[model samples]
Target chain A: MGFSISVEGGQGEATIKLVGELDAAAAPQFKEAIEKLAVDKPQRLILHMDQLEFMASAGLRVLIFARQKMGADVSLYVIGSRGPVLNTLKMSGFHHSVYLQDTYAPE
Target chain B: MDKLTLPAVLASLAELRRYAREAAAAAGIEEERSYQLQLAVDEIATNIISYGYKDAGPMAQIVIGGEITADVLIITLEDHAPAFDPRTRQMPDDDELSKPLEERTIGGLGIYLAMEGVDRFDYRREGERNLNIFEMRRRNG
Candidate 1:
């Protein structure tokens, strides 16, 4: 329906699972989550986006926000983003800002 | 072609997307292509609604309509805001995109992504209305 963000993992790693549509209306919740997560200073911030149904430019802006908030050293990963969500990332060239993978195995 | 009149606001985006989905499906557009169509429309609508006018008052109304023919898909957005042309924007140059995150600009990517998969995108001014036309060749073509 809307958007939900859940943070998992611990120590230097955290997985933020995003579900539902990520449009302009839903972006605030996402940004709030990112703001909260940034305080943890996780070395690896994994965005698990397999269930992310749609992503508009607003959502893309949040991805940029996360990069700037987390700084240059935090290695960010976008996992399993498909359909419009993936296409939006690729089309806007935001795909370059994160490591995209079919799956992420926590070590 | 089915039509929807959306208030220019972020709150209207979900319903705008719903209308886009129904229009695309009724036109026999498949899921993938429909997504592209929706993305293209969303980007434009967001721009017109978010920036075209500065008012919490009666927002500008954006009318969107679409038709898919045997060989092509055409989407039209009619807005009564100040005349602006989206096609005049060039795709973000390599240098802009290549800029480091902290150095990159905040805006401009939305309109750039709007034209990504479409075959031809045109903009025109008719009296007080700005008509944006988005066309794409069907995959089978």
Candidate 2:
């Protein structure tokens, strides 16, 4: 499957839901979404990735871009990532950089 | 063994991954290992298309072939773009991987995962072709 991304937000929180395969071809779109979200400077960024079946190094680069773009003060949460998507995050130790949860339970 | 040749472009990655996954399954590779193999192939193939074929012109092609031996499943990626060896790419060290988000660099993560995900990864250059070999040990059940 090709990649698709959507953003939902209100106030200080924003959630980006990513679906389908995220390869080099789709990384730019994701990076663009992050760029748009960074403009608002939300306090919290949540990535919903349950349906994101595959993620390559390109996707990882964008995750880094999103984190840096969001800055250190913002909290980033990754929810429902599984299979190869979860494996990529865990293998690259990216799971440590963000809050990983089965569901979005904001503190 | 089944071999396929496709344009060395980003769009061909999905079909390449599907080919790898199906080959792994036919070779009796488990689900997790199959995904790893797929990732490994995608990473190297991406590098080949993105870097190797950067200025090699429009007709550049990436050839992917799968071989199932008695004990191992091997997938080979060949490209005529350049003789770049993915193993030579510097991977992120432990210290680098543990760094804070803002301080970390994303370079080499793909090659790192590609090498680490598979049981064995090898690279070689034959004449003008760059061959990346990814291998996984078949289960003995």
Candidate 3:
């Protein structure tokens, strides 16, 4: 299947849930969400990707874009990414740019 | 061994994936070697579409072939793009990943990862086309 994204507010942060395959086809939608979040300028951004099964290099590019659009002061969290999706991040060395956790803890 | 041409778009990734899987299986590639070959092909094919031929026109085509000899999987990809050797590109430094996205470089990491994933990688500029050959053997072998 293709990909989908859902953004919601949680406590003091904004959480974006990504589902399905994140590839070149899904990058535009992903980019739009990050741009919208940049307007709100949340203190933290949490990406829930437990259901994300795959990620292409284009998807990784969007993740990099999100990191830049959100700015350095904003904390970015990626939760529950596994399998090929997580390997893409680890292989590209993106696992270091964001905080990765099995579960998001409300602070 | 099989060959097919699809538009060099992100939409074509599924086609590439299937090609890699079927080709590896037909070659009787081991599980670990199959996975590594798949990853390497994905990275290279994606790079070809994204960077090698970023323009719109006759979509760049990929020729994939594989064989198993003595428990080793040998896959080769031939494409008509500029003479760019992915292997010669430098890998990202340990600290490069932590930098801000804007400060970080965009390309090169995929090629680096592909190199690391396979047991052997070789590239050559064959006349008008770029030829890349990758090999992977059973880890315990």
Q: Which candidate leads in TM-score?
A: 2
Provide the TM-score for each candidate, comma-separated: 0.89, 0.96, 0.85
TM-score of chain B, candidates 1 onward in order: 0.87, 0.96, 0.82
Ranking by DockQ: 2, 1, 3
Per-residue accuracy of model 2 over B42-118 as CA lDDT, tens digit each = 98998888888898788989999999999999999999976788878899998888777788888899999999889
Candidate 3 Cα outliers beyond 4 Å, as residue runs: A9-11, B27-33, B98-102, B139-141
lDDT (Cα, 0-100) at B122 in candidate 2: 93
Candidate 3, residues B27-85, lDDT tens digits: the string is 66665556666767878887877778876466567777666677666777777877778
lDDT of 2 by residue, A1-105 (tens): 799999876549988999999999899999998888888899999999999988998998988888888888888899999877887787788867888889999
Per-prediction share of native contacts kept:
0.53, 0.77, 0.40
Q: What C-alpha lDDT values do all the predictions have?
A: 0.79, 0.89, 0.76
Note the DockQ of each predicted structure: 0.60, 0.80, 0.50
The CAPRI class of candidate 3 is: medium
What is the lDDT, from 0 to 100, of the residue A36 in candidate 2? 88
lDDT of each residue in A6-55, candidate 1, tens digit only: 87756598788999888777889888888888888888889999999988
